[model samples]
Target: MEHITSTPTAKAPAERFTGDVYLNMIEAPASPAHLASALVRFTPGARTNWHSHANGQILYITDGVGLVGTRDGNVVRVSAGQIVKCPPGEEHWHGGTDTTLMAHIAMVVGDAEGDGTTWLEPVTAEQYAHALSSQGGS
Candidate 1:
């Protein structure tokens, strides 16, 4: 068995994230064949921008609560022990809710090169407002 080197924590881009967010590489293909995972953390009000992947992506919530948005105007609220998936090429974004710190294991599947993670625009205030309204602001 080979050992995987640990990398220092990287800062999330201000253009994409709103609050303190961090991630750590867990298992990579080099360490375990065909396996890759990341431990992600999002502070209150932190979230990702609209984006899509060529293959797909999965989010396994590990703590607090999280939220996800789809292009078709669907906002899903997820909590610990919940799992969320985004199909290939489906524009969406995920992150912490308004007043909670969210964390999850994000698994990016398929090709590492053309795997496709196209980052789109950030979640606008209007979009967030609409999402909250749709969910009764819960």
Candidate 2:
């Protein structure tokens, strides 16, 4: 097995996020292993744009609180140690809450040729407001 070195941290672009976010890639898909992983950290009120994956994504929350939302108005409030799963081709967005910081290790199942994410429009304040006000979890 070949050892993988640590990658430098990268700032998440504004075009794809609402606030400050950072990413530290843990692994990139290598031949025979088409899975990629990264540690993603988000500042308060920061989140990803609506997106989907070809083979789905898995997230293990590492710290603080956050929300995972879908276009269908299903919003899940998540905290440290939780795991959130997004199925293939299901558009969703995730990020920190209005008053909390959140960090998670995101693993995407796909090849290295691309980031494996199909990004769309950013989440608007109205969407975020509804998320914050909604009572998630049964």
Candidate 3:
């Protein structure tokens, strides 16, 4: 057994995030392990871009309130102690709400096909507005 050390927290890239988001690497799929995870924190109104995983993704909320949305324009509000699952190859985005900070442990599985996430364009203002509407602005 190995005692895992903490990795540096990094700001989510502008090309892949709409606002300030930070992530700390929890695991990175070492030998014999195909699983990787990160502890991600989002500032109020911050969110991720359109992206997908070849093997899906799992998010375990750890703090504050957030929202997860899909390409279909559906948005779901999530809070601490909640879980959000993204199906394989399904494009989606997630982040903090307009007035709440949010954090989650994001986990994913890797295969020989690719790394884990395929990032696309950032989520637009209109889309975020729709998300807020879906959440009733609360």
Q: Tell me how far the alpha carbon of residue 38 in candidate 3 is from the true structure, in angstroms, after superposition.
A: 0.2
**Which has the greatest TM-score?**
3
Q: In candidate 3, which residue ranges exceed 4 Å CA deviation? A: none
* Pairs clashing within candidate 1: none
Q: 83-112 in candidate 3: lDDT tens per residue?
A: 999999999999999899999999999865
Give the per-residue lDDT digits (tens) of candidate 1, residues 1-138: 878788667777777666788978786544223456788899877788888877778999999987888999888888999999888889998887777788999887645453346888888877876776676664
- Give lDDT for model 3: 0.90
TM-score per prediction, in order, is 0.84, 0.91, 0.93
Candidate 3, run of 10 with poorest lDDT: 108-117
Candidate models: Cα lDDT each: 0.79, 0.91, 0.90
Candidate 2 lowest-lDDT run of ten? 129-138
lDDT of 2 by residue, 67-105 (tens): 999999999999999999999999999999988999999
Taking all chains together, the TM-score of candidate 3 against the true structure is 0.93
